[model samples]
Target: MPTFTALTTLPGQAAAEAFVEALERLEPEPTGVGIFEIEDGSGFWEVGGYFAEAPDAAALDLLAAAFGARTFVVSEVPETDWVAHVKRELAPVTAGRFFVYGSHDAGRVPEGAVALLIEAAMAFGTGHHGTTKGCLQALDRLVAAGVEARIAADIGCGTAVLAMAAARIWGHPVLASDIDPVAVEVAQANAAANGLADKVICLEAAGFDHPRLREAAPFDLIFANILKGPLVELAPDMAATCATGGHVILSGLLNDQAEAVLTAYDAAGFGLCNRVEIGEWTTLTLLKPHG
Candidate 1:
């Protein structure tokens, strides 16, 4: 089988929309898959990610000939070659039970766990990034202590992996939220794939203010693996909604940026618990004040 590549340029907004559209329309097909996206600052975007069957060599030739000079790049690929390329290029990142694939030589995720079996895709959360793996490690450490958390929330739960993990590990109902509808869809799909749909409630909301958020009121444990600036800004709201005596895991911070984040949480009534570093990322777990 030959892989097919379709490349075209569209604006930023258009490119993003095209990517999402392509993703949603994709069905279970035996196609070699890989998505490569480049944004042309000139209000345009170039995109391509697909593998085609071999018998279509003539079709590929026609496609290439049809788009001769306008502005398109098309490539034909053999199926096996594409698969081998993706798997080999996608080094597995494991932190706890999460597995992520990204740059082969990168310390994408934290150490000390098994990689998940899910095939790598453009989707988020495979413990391959410092922020995501940091969160995974944080959850692993928490679970290792045999803690049973109930009523949890995952803010900006990209792939909903954290929420799914919580539900699987602690038998808790985890509420995962993200403002992006696409992210919500990805999270929901991932949750279902992992058999966690029953316990993980995926929602689209405007930050912590989503109506579904109320359903998870005063969560006993909250996971916020978003960036540092947003984490600081969300401190007050998280503090208010996170119950006293509960736990909060915060990541998406560089080791150097950990103190400022901790300071913000401290002011919001959380006491430092543990700070773990994996790669260049750090995840800090904070316990609500006892006094």
Candidate 2:
């Protein structure tokens, strides 16, 4: 089966969402349509659709124009064994004390490293991306500095990698929440796979909105490795949920956007404790002060 994808970027979320709705109503309706914010501080949203057959280029162009988006670029996606390809391309990643690898490389985990098994099918936060690697490195640095977090949370935790890491180190239960139910399920599965099912509790929630998260307030540590916009929006909530003198590790930011996120967290009562730059991404460790 040939799969075709049509993708375009626009400035506003609203426009991108409306464009997605339009894409769903096309003559040859897309098999799936998705809208995502481009997290590079571009303030742009990308709208993409996949079709079993090639989409109508003329219709896509007209829709793009109507939505103030760039011309839609449609391309055929080659059918390949994506899992096999990812396994071949994604070697194990080492971030400080944590080693993230797929089962194919299970035998390669270092003797002393904390092993996190993440298959490529799980996708997000396999520790291969700079953002996830930065967060893991930041966590390792905190541990090396003798920081102990009894209670922690991983907000927007895609695969619960951070939560698992904390649980592995501290032997304490960590709350892992994601807005997407599918991600929450994946998190739970990953936690089980890592044998941290008892230590990492997975939930479906946006930021701190769920009851479990609310009850787990004043967490000793929090990891919000989400994009800049959500990170900024959740600053005040993070301040309230984090305990005094507790730490928050944040990533999913471009190097240029770190300052803005810092400014937001600073205003929300966090002070920068450490910052690490990996490739084009930046991870920040912030501390809440005790009065």
Candidate 3:
């Protein structure tokens, strides 16, 4: 099917929400939206929405003005070709024992490194980003701590990188979810590619708000590697799903944003177990207070 992908940056506090709402109000609604960070260094968020048909000239003109004193553009994209574009453009990622292959991290890993091979698709976690790697490292350290955990959840599992990692190394039962259909497909494919198909269950979900997420309550470990906003919003849900004394690890946050995230987590009664930094990203581990 054909789709439209538009990426736009709006300055100021509500950029992310504005772009998201505009895409939602479109006549035919986009198939998906790929949020990106432009060079602005502002909190401004970008969205690449996929539609069912080509956007006409009028669409572009309206798009440019939608942000008003901001920036935006719409491009028609065929559904089948977006993955090829992702593989060609996204940077490399390395998390824990996994090394994501891309132009930047290509050939830079040590010979004996434990690597998780991945292609750049619309799916989230690639080991190269600090948030993903931070979570992976935290997970590994937990295992190293010799804590016995039974069930695990990867909310916003993205490319299923972390889900696959947990399942592959720990052999635990895993559930992975993503709001994006493309990400769901990618996560499933990547898990099977890593021979983790049996250990990991991949599905589509919009945060912990999914029916399945509610059904599978009280997970021993939970991972959410999304933006700070969703992280804060989903705090209560993540805590509810965690088994008492169990753990939750979160990422996709900058160091400056860590304090607010910690406050949210704290309010949910999940105290900080540890924190790590990689490049410009932050990951935190938390333990549910025992009753």
- The numbered model that scores best in TM-score is 2
The predicted structure with the larger lDDT, 1 or 2, is: 2
How does candidate 1 fare on TM-score? 0.65
When summed lDDT is taken over every stretch of 10 residues in candidate 1, the lowest stretch is 32-41
Residues forming the 10-long window of minimal summed lDDT in candidate 3: 96-105
List ranges where model 3 is wrong by over 4 Å.
1-68, 71-114, 120-124
Distance from true position, residue 10, model 1, in Å?
23
Better structure of 1 and 3 per lDDT: 3
Which residue pairs does candidate 3 place in steric collision? Answer: 4-51, 93-127, 93-128, 94-127, 94-128, 97-114, 98-116, 124-158, 124-159
Clashes of each: 11, 0, 9
RMSD of every prediction? 8.8, 1.6, 5.7
**lDDT for each candidate structure:** 0.71, 0.93, 0.76
lDDT ranking, best first: 2, 3, 1
Q: Which portions of model 1 miss their true places by more than 4 Å?
A: 1-86, 97-118
Per-residue CA lDDT of candidate 3, range 1-291, in tens? 655666666655466666677766775666776665543366655666677776554665576576662444656554566567677666555455555563334577668555565765533567766788899889878888986667888988888888877776677879999898888888888877767888888888788767766787788899899888889999988877899999999998988888899999999999999999888889999999897
- Candidate 2 regions exceeding 4 Å error are 38-44
